[model samples]
Target: MRILVILRRVLDPAGIVAHRRLRRLFINREEYLIQPGDHSALEAALRIKDLGGAEVVVVSGQPEPDDDTVCRGLAMGADGAIYLSGEGFAGADDGVAARLLQAVVDRLGGADLVLVGMTTLDTAQAQLGPRLAGALGWPQIVGAWSVEIVDGRVRAVRRDGDDYVVVETDLPAVVTVPGRALEPRYPDGARLVNVYRGEGGMGEAVLRWDVADLLHPEGLVPLLENRGRDFPPERELGVRVEGTTEEVAQAVAEALRARLRGA
Candidate 1:
């Protein structure tokens, strides 16, 4: 089974605060700590490989030297990685990224399973996985913690609060994993050296279809919800006490009554 994961280079908090006033949410130029969501997705894919999946591939947004997520993805355990770059791809919303990723998948011969994080930290738009599934026309299940690739079929365990589920799907499907899937593993030191030592890295590097023109904001039209809501209202509390067990209840009621009267 071939698996694909989309990784993003996130801005460090200090970098964000430094330029937040400019309204630039990201500074992709600097080194990045892998987004936990991205790590979770990769971790799940690794587990699938460890359990016998044929291959694991990572797809990242950009290939700049500072893009730690893509480089580390190979170090961590992915068999290969693909990077996409183009003018109109900048500032792509979740749906747009999903669209772009679908294009990448088509060129990569599609995947047996696609893994994505539950939600992107910067955007908090937990919609990418489903959107990608929509674009790829695959059946998808969200928040999976464990996945098994069996004879070209997928059996995944998804958590719904305290309970969990086991679902089955054919190959060429999409799946979004939550942190519950598995913990990240230490870099495969020896394998890392061996893989990078080869020329042009693992797997073929393909540019895929460029969808910038089709994905421009205006081309899709718009119906954005109002952003930046006010914080929820605060609640105040008061305490009361009274005498004997039975009479105490009455006394507490009287005290509450008096307090309400005072108010």
Candidate 2:
């Protein structure tokens, strides 16, 4: 069995500072880490592999220097990795990525299962897995807490309202793991060194595939464009009501009525 995992990088939030008064963001430090959700997804794939000898391959569309996420996956235990890059793919949104990754799955000769993060940290976009599932015409399970495969079928634990339920789907399905679903294991130190140094048979573990070769450049155009960040206006101080309980309640009701009238 072959399992495909999607991984990506996100900016470390600790390094950024937002100034509401200035209406701007300041970068005191520039740092990146594997997306938390994706990290857990990788761990889920590794656990599956450990249970039943499945080949785990990780794929990423992050640009050249951002291949760190895929490398980290390899160090953590992925059997292979694919890095998708090109000028046209630099700014791909979820829609464009779904199409591009669809072509990637085709080129990979298809997979028995696909795993990815339920949402992104920076953008909070939870559309990639479902979009890819739609592109592939496969069943999809979102926000999975735990996953396992048996008898050519996949089973996962998902939240339904206030309860967690076990759901099962056939092979060749897409599963999106939540960020905190599982505790991600640390990368093997020796394997990480070998991967970065391109030694110990780790050099050939990663393959670089240009997006231009997989699909026409026209298809790489993003459907969404980022105009810029827009911060909300600074908040005004609240008026304090000083009186008895009934008076304060009346004051609150009046304030609500005024706000509702404005609305």
The model with the greatest TM-score is 2
Q: What is candidate 1's lDDT per residue for 94-193, written digit by digit as tens?
A: 7667777776777767678888888766556678899989988999987777777777888888776788878889878888877545788988777566
Q: How many Å off is the CA of 245 in candidate 2? A: 7.7
After TM-score superposition, the amount by which residue 71's alpha carbon in candidate 1 deviates from its true location, in angstroms, is 0.3
lDDT of 1: 0.70
What's the distance in Å from true for residue 13, model 2? 0.8
lDDT on C-alpha atoms for all candidate structures? 0.70, 0.91
Candidate 1 residue 167 Cα shift, in angstroms, is 1.6
Per-candidate TM equals 0.70, 0.90
Q: What ranges in model 1 sit over 4 Å off?
A: 13-31, 63-65, 190-263
Candidate 1 has what TM-score? 0.70
